[model samples]
Target: MELGACPKSMRYGPCGGVRTGGGCEVVDEPCPFVGRPLVEWAGTELAPRAIELPRFLVDHRPTGDDRVDRQVLDDYAASGVAVLLGDHLDDPPAVDRVAAAERTVDAGVPTIATITGRDRSTDERAEMIDGLLAAGVAAVLCVTGDHPSARFTAHPDVTFVSEGTLLAGEVRSRGGRVAVAESPAAEPTRQRAARLVEKQRAGADIAVLNHSGPVADVIAFAEQASALGCRLPMYAPVPVMTDLASMAALEQFPGLTIADDAVNAMHTSSDPFSTGLDLAVAMAGELLGSGSIAGVNLSGVATSGGAVERGRVMRRVVDAVTA
Candidate 1:
């Protein structure tokens, strides 16, 4: 391959996205900086991995924010959160998710509401879409809601809902940007690849990987999807590793991955918060650089401060990488 162009910031600065495995995050190639006698390679060797900053989103937990809406919105907005995501957390009458998204839009930030394809009747599902449209929600992620058994076994938030593909088709016909979730891919299989293609054929604009796992999983899924003829824009989910308890919770959630190394690092590090932050930066940089991925969604239960700080740092990394 020809030498890719580099930015001034990276031309002479330390490369933070250099993986612990010693691979260049900007390119899938070996770290050119490693064992190189040429000093300029430190700055100019790896061309900027991205031509533009990918879409960065903050996944906000569901809140009865009549209590803290203003503070939450202001905090996220100030923290440089570019997009807001309100999950269809376990709550009665999944339609409530649309209202949750409405609250996000009311905050003046673009938001995405996750709608489940179960629980409600067909009319209810359509009404939910109408509610989001009327509320001016910028986007919606239609998901095949959790199974009924999950409510009792998992966090109280799991619930079955409508079909995600049908929801995406409806949202598209109504002119709302729509997304769907994919999962369980440290290793990709044909079944998973075919499902992704089916979802895209159903009108999903973006394929949001369902787990908070390693960047490799996302890349692997993308490659498999491409091989299967699924052209959906792929968006990887990044975890907000604050408390170990919350981080560990991801393991129980189906379709998400929290690698053992990550788990161990967060558990053993003197400052787990910074350690997790570095991991997020590295993963986001890798995903952004990998041309297969369209963007990333930062997901976790974090304070508005934590969420904002995550976005700020990731944005800086993007700025530097694409500088």
Candidate 2:
């Protein structure tokens, strides 16, 4: 059987190239398979996050089902895109983030683990960093993760610097790439923009624009960043809604921007999932055309379609859009 050109190597397979110092021997491109997925993020990626077993998954799926995880990672990795693993939402961070990342690596998929900083401390950051280093992961996407418990909320009176910033600095010292999330949906105030630049200087190697809304807004955010001189490899997540019901539900969730165009298009379609997929593909094309972001993530929210189907559909969209 014949095979297509491998994007990672940009060469003919059966993938005989030896990666020296973690780069392709032929093209000198970074080894797409080694290290954490985010560090190896090219211009596009399929980011599948790990979430706590929701009430939805509790009855339908078993806890700790690594098979689905491995299969999902493998499918995306084969397409020359890195797999980003997300942190579960729990007090004290219930599951081991490093172990979750290790699963991605084990599937031969590069991955980025989400590191939450709110309601946390520096010492805890040190421990998590140690675990990531031990897990052989190379990149991370750190965020001031939402705080329902307020256990680690950063109060203004306390002069709370984000854990993501500290982790970025530490990751830099270790020679691994670090990513910090950016809120492009918010009005780009000088204060917020300046903080992002400072984050880059402090050791953040890249940016993941928080879940975006309209494509115009996303494009505008990129332009705003350019104007602000925030030059970092960046990616924006493509929000997926499997149905109008799901779309309506997300209205209360700030920053999960659903473009007006997308809503109109999806509302008219008999097949909302397919409509959503098309909208995502179109959004990806525009985002890449802007030449601002290095990639796009499929926010990994539960779609009306099952998680596996949503991811698979997004992988197809990434291939078509990025190609």
Candidate 3:
């Protein structure tokens, strides 16, 4: 199968959203790149360059109100946590990511802005990166975003003109720090690390590992990537599930797999919020102590109108881990 067969048009072949049965995430067909050899990076070789960023990172969902967003940035800044400002399919239509990043940076918070190939052309992405860097973002996370699910109403018809591997080099050429994502539990698991190596060669400075399974699995993935000559510092995601709503929201993310034990514990607990918070803290601590990863990303969905509450939960986990 060729790259044209992929709905995302990713030269990197299978993306993180490949189904367990080796099916495409967007179409009713087997993933074309499933059994093929990993596509080697074809871009000019560029060494990964380090950038200063916080050890504790949280996914910030803009509430679409400037005052609320400012207060949230101030809160995270005070807590010594960096905020990842990215465009997700579920983000409110009014949420302007560049403006949000500008506000976060202006507020003296470390901001990692994300750029995806899902809905923008190469020139559009380049311009976006330039705007983000000018706004003083600490780094730019280059990702191949998930295919738009049919459940999203009025989803735009767009093309993925440049995937993360290609975007990494683009970011580097524009003098911006580059962070790329890897899914260890996705199909072609063994090739995942090799893919990271290619990403690093394409100028990725950091790797953010998606929620795969247990902490042990995360560590193993890091080790595998290291053995394959991937030297980029890695950040492991710690799921922030404080309630059933948040848990359900997180489960909607493609290629994410929370351990069954943790899920059961959260479901059976008398106080799910406390149970989930404790579980997140424990997981963060374990990942930090594993000596495999450089940091942890407090990653999950917030219930409707629960962004502030979710931030409090993230703060608690950060405090517990750093204390």
Point out where model 1 deviates above 4 Å.
1-54, 87-95, 154-161, 186-188, 303-323
Runs in model 2 deviating more than 4 A are 1-63, 90-94, 119-121, 149-162, 187-191, 245-250
| Weakest 10 consecutive residues of candidate 1 by summed lDDT | 41-50
Better of 1 and 3 by TM-score: 3
Per-residue CA lDDT of model 3 for 270-323, tens digit only, reads 988789888999999998888999889899874434667667778888888788
lDDT scores in order: 0.58, 0.54, 0.84
TM-scores of the candidates are 0.70, 0.69, 0.96
Across residues 1-323, which tens digit of lDDT does each residue of candidate 2 receive? 11222232121111112232444332335434333222111222222223211010000111255676556666666665665566534313334667776776676655666776544466776677677767766467766454232222433322223445555666566656677776554322223455566566666666776655777777677667657667776676676566786677545443345677777887899988778777767777777667766677655443665546655765777667756
User: Which 10-residue span in candidate 3 carries the lowest summed lDDT?
Assistant: 149-158
lDDT-better candidate, 1 vs 3: 3
- Number of the top candidate by TM-score? 3
Residue pairs of candidate 1 with colliding backbone atoms: 11-43, 90-157, 116-162, 117-161, 117-162, 117-163, 118-161, 118-162, 211-256
Candidates arranged by lDDT, highest first:
3, 1, 2
**Model 1 per-residue lDDT tens digits across residues 238-284:** 77575575576565453456666778888899987678777767777
